[model samples]
Target: MIKTLDSVSNHEHRQIIEKTGYKVETLRIWKTGILKHSISNPSNEQLETFAMNVDAVLEKSNLHIDSKNEIRANCTSHFLNERRRTSKQGKETKENIKVVNNIKKKIRDNNLTVVKADKGSCMVILDRNLYINKVEEFMNENGFVKLDNNPTSRLINKVKNFRVSKEFEDKFGKYKNLIPSNPKIPKLYGLPKLHMDNIPIRPIVSLINTPVYKISKFLSDKLKDLTEFKPTYSIKNSGQLAESLKNLQIRRVLN
Candidate 1:
């Protein structure tokens, strides 16, 4: 895989790829699945740890709840952080440029897709009819209803307010709909690299209403993983940036 990615192009071939369906910022190499851990059933030790953590948090806050109170939310946050940490420390999974070129070659050779090279990037005009059929079947099986208006038509604007009003209450917290939040489990956001890049650089997941809400929630959850360090504890000399900012404000008020 490494050799294949290496052989594609150093720089010149990037333009070739842009002409294909994958334009700049849309192309990404595939990475390992990010949400695999949370979906699987937890082990005994994992369950015990989760229970203990929830108990500790609740005890401090004077909150009490039964075991069925959906602690999965908290556990999912912790597990995703673990995965992100592992990914940052792990090796790069992206095949070099050559791998992409090779994929293009294979698609064209088999007549599976038509590839075109443009100055900016390569374009691969996939069979839209085939994809539409597949999507129709998937939507039918998934219990989704079609909208009365065409998604791209001016008629969409007529009912656009309905979408805005409803999607917020349904997806995010009250009055906090527009924020870009991280997902708890990474989904196939229907962008380029069908299965690649857990986080696309500039994701189009926002274009689709359901995925926009999901991705935003995940982003919000991911932000909580920032570490809080303390200074003058005698063990660690450094404080976290957030803590330092707070300390500076205190000193200014005191002075």
Candidate 2:
């Protein structure tokens, strides 16, 4: 039930619309609230325009939009829709999961392949035969051989059974941080770099899934602190490097 009070601010108007559904089932609510976002110069036309913006936002969010105003405050009406209590997330049934898995299996069975383009900004799809041919050609040109067996299991076992000396532990902390638990095989994918003279396949090996990833990360972080403000090792470009070199004090360094 909307009590027609004086004009309220736009923010207050949206709050009511968001709470109240197409029909206000609760008749017990008699409280009216106003928030001072700005000076409330109540106008009916402004309310209508504000409601249109609310509709756009709600629509974009995949939310229910109440086109008609059922609640009134002051002389103006504000749009309100009931919250969808039925809408839930992560409530998929077992049958739904099985169906989804089956669909995925079917897709994989057809020998479809995917790789991240620009590190997951998007994916580029190509013919399976063409992709394999390109990768094989690159490997052959580089004199790389394809291994007969998977080596991920062997690597994981080796890391798990590894031992560290006391002196090493004292300098670099514990052994646990240096080893990855349940490490997946490192993945390699190539991106067709278009900006190059010849669009070369820029081979990338995903280090995140490697057995020594944790050790690499720990060592990298420890070593990074030493290089924070070094004079010669500038990464920002040639201009920044020149500026940094100009500011270096060579006499003080020798002394």
TM-score of each: 0.21, 0.44
Check candidate 2 and list the clashing pairs. Answer: 5-74, 17-79, 17-80, 21-81, 21-82
Off by over 4 Å in 1: 1-99, 108-132, 150-255
lDDT score for candidate 2 against the true structure: 0.51
Q: How many backbone clashes does candidate 2 have?
A: 5
Clash numbers, per candidate = 22, 5
Give the top-scoring candidate (lDDT).
2
Q: For residues 87-159, write the lDDT of model 2, one tens digit per residue.
A: 2212323334444455345336655454443332333333455557767778889988889999888888888
Against the correct fold, how does model 2 do in TM-score?
A: 0.44
Model 1, TM vs. native: 0.21
Worst 10 residues of 1 by lDDT: 194-203
